[model samples]
Target chain A: MIKQERAVRTREALIRAAAESFDQDGFTVASLTRISSRAGVSSGALHFHFASKAALADAVEEAAVVVLRALTHDAGRPGSSRLQHLVDATHRLAEALRDDVVLRAGFELSGEAARVPRTDLRVSWRDRVERQARRCEENGELREDVTVGRVVSAVVAATVGFEVLGVRNRAWLAPGTIAEFWRLLLPTLASDAVVARIRPEGTLRSAG
Target chain B: MIKQERAVRTREALIRAAAESFDQDGFTVASLTRISSRAGVSSGALHFHFASKAALADAVEEAAVVVLRALTHDAGRPGSSRLQHLVDATHRLAEALRDDVVLRAGFELSGEAARVPRTDLRVSWRDRVERQARRCEENGELREDVTVGRVVSAVVAATVGFEVLGVRNRAWLAPGTIAEFWRLLLPTLASDAVVARIRPEGTLRSAG
Candidate 1:
């Protein structure tokens, strides 16, 4: 039992280290030896946990999906309007992206052509956002003129934009930046009654 | 004069080759030998034209700036409303990005962290957009409630997002995609009187 627990901890540490390396150097150049060193593990130990750099990246991507899936599930809690759920989810994602290297690396690695990711994060995110938008349409929360495809494209593009821009400027990840986007977009997207009920700041209190 | 003309053509070919390499392989991994070969030039000739890879990247960035500067200048024609010019420029940029490898590479190399870019394309683009938004404010073209800063951030973010997304999917660069974004945004942004006059097609005929 003790050995199993220790192995699990080492694996987690190595995953975190690999995510940092991949995020900084990109998938093509990130070295497994360096990742192990960053994690304070021997090369043999890294090999034991992950057979190759691609496997390590897959693990990192899986971990990121876990974090993202939780955020999506939490945001989609029953009783909230679908549009509000999407608003909250985007804010949460931006906050996670600002604070978490794993998520950032997941996004970066998925975009890289040198490696085939186990799952494409952008497609996953677009599908999730599209699902919620469809739900909003079914609930009649969307404005009569707004199409699900249009909202999906705008929201996906803006969120992906924030991720790319945040690479250079951390300010792009700020809650206010996302809030401002929602504030501008919501009036045009949601029905009049729904617009009044939704808060651009999301249900969560702003740390800023 | 014959030798000088040949030298200029060689230099142009080298720039095109380097842009292709940088756009496909990224700045860190792209090599001078490969670029020279792609340009059908000798290593000695490449060195004579460019001191180093960094110098080559700088030249590509400068050429992109020339293309971008023309787009901005054309969009800001004196007779048009500042907002209209801004819209037209973004559409032109999307088309240029779709057709021009040097401009695409300029953006990619600037985003790369492995090397410092002579010019940061994102910053340059944001500044140009901000200036136009301010001009729109001066001309009283923006809706009374819209702030210049908000418009700048959204426009920059969305445009940057399109560039990044276009890396993987050329469809993102289509005129209709950009047109849809403006179609959704312009009504809310322009005063009711101006909204009717502004075409989301961006005053340019779609090649499609």
Candidate 2:
């Protein structure tokens, strides 16, 4: 059991180091030697954890997905509309992006032309957002004039923009920015009666 | 005059070749030899035109800026509101990204950490968008409840998102996608009296 725990810790360290390398140097230029050195591990141990650079990137993407799933899992609290869930989720995502390097690196790698990874973090996130928007429509929370396609496109593009821009400027993902986006849309997006109830800044439990 | 025109042609070819290389291989892995060959020029000729890869990238960026300026310069039609000009410019920019490889590559290189160019296309674009949003406010076209900062952030981020995504999928920058975004925002974005006059699809003179 002790040996297994040690192996897990070593894997985590390698993954973290790889994430840092990929983030700073980009996937095309990141060096495995530097990653192992940053992780404080021997070449043999690094290879044991991840055979190839692509494998290491895959591990990073998977780990990021785990973090994403955790944050999005609890978004649908009881008594909250799906639209509110989505609004809160955007804020939570921006916060995670601001704080978590692994998630950010995973997203960066997915967009890169260097190597084709098995997972696409942006596509995955976009799918989740679409699902929630559809739910809002089904629940009659969406305004009649707004098509699901428009809502999905705008929300995905804007949030993806925040993620891409956040790579250079964290302020793009600030709560105020995301809140203001919802504030501009909520009036036209939500049914007239539902607009008052939806909080652009997010609900108490979900925002945190 | 004949010699000067040929020199200009050679320079243009080299810039186009470099833009294509940078777009496909990214700024880091792009090869100078490949670019010169693609331009149908000798290595000696390429060196005569550009001292280094960074210099070539700067040329490409400058060329792109010229294209961007031309598209935006005619946006403010005499009969149109500032809001309409901003709307039209987004469409024109999207069309440019879709059809103009040099413009697209300039944007890609600006965001790259591989080299630091004197000009930043994304920053330049954000500043331009901010200026248009401010103009809308000055003309009383923007709703009193809508802050200029919110418009700037959302518009810049979303357009950047479209550009980034369009690198992989042309559909992201499709007129429909951009038009839908404005559709969702225009009602809430324009002041009550000004909402009816703004064209989300862009004016005929500008959309093309």
Give the whole-model CA lDDT for all candidates, comma-separated: 0.86, 0.87
* Per-residue accuracy of model 1 over B1-208 as CA lDDT, tens digit each: 9999999999999999999999888877899999999999999999999999999999999988888888887435565778878888889999999999999898887677566678888788888999889998988899888888888877888888888888888888888888878877787788878878777778778533
lDDT of 2 by residue, B106-143 (tens): 99886675466677888888988988888889888888
- Model 1, native contacts kept: 0.36
Across residues A43-129, which tens digit of lDDT does each residue of candidate 2 receive? 899999898999999999999998888767644556668888889888888998998889988888877865666888888888888
Q: Would you give me the overall lDDT of model 1?
A: 0.86
Model 2, which residues run further than 4 Å from truth?
Answer: A204-208, B205-208
Query: Every prediction's TM-score for the first chain?
Result: 0.95, 0.94
lDDT (Cα, tens digit) per residue for candidate 1, span A6-101 = 999999999999999988888777898899999999999999999999899999999998888877774445667889889989999999998999
Tally clashing residue pairs in candidate 1: 0
Report the C-alpha displacement of residue A30, candidate 1, in angstroms.
2.2
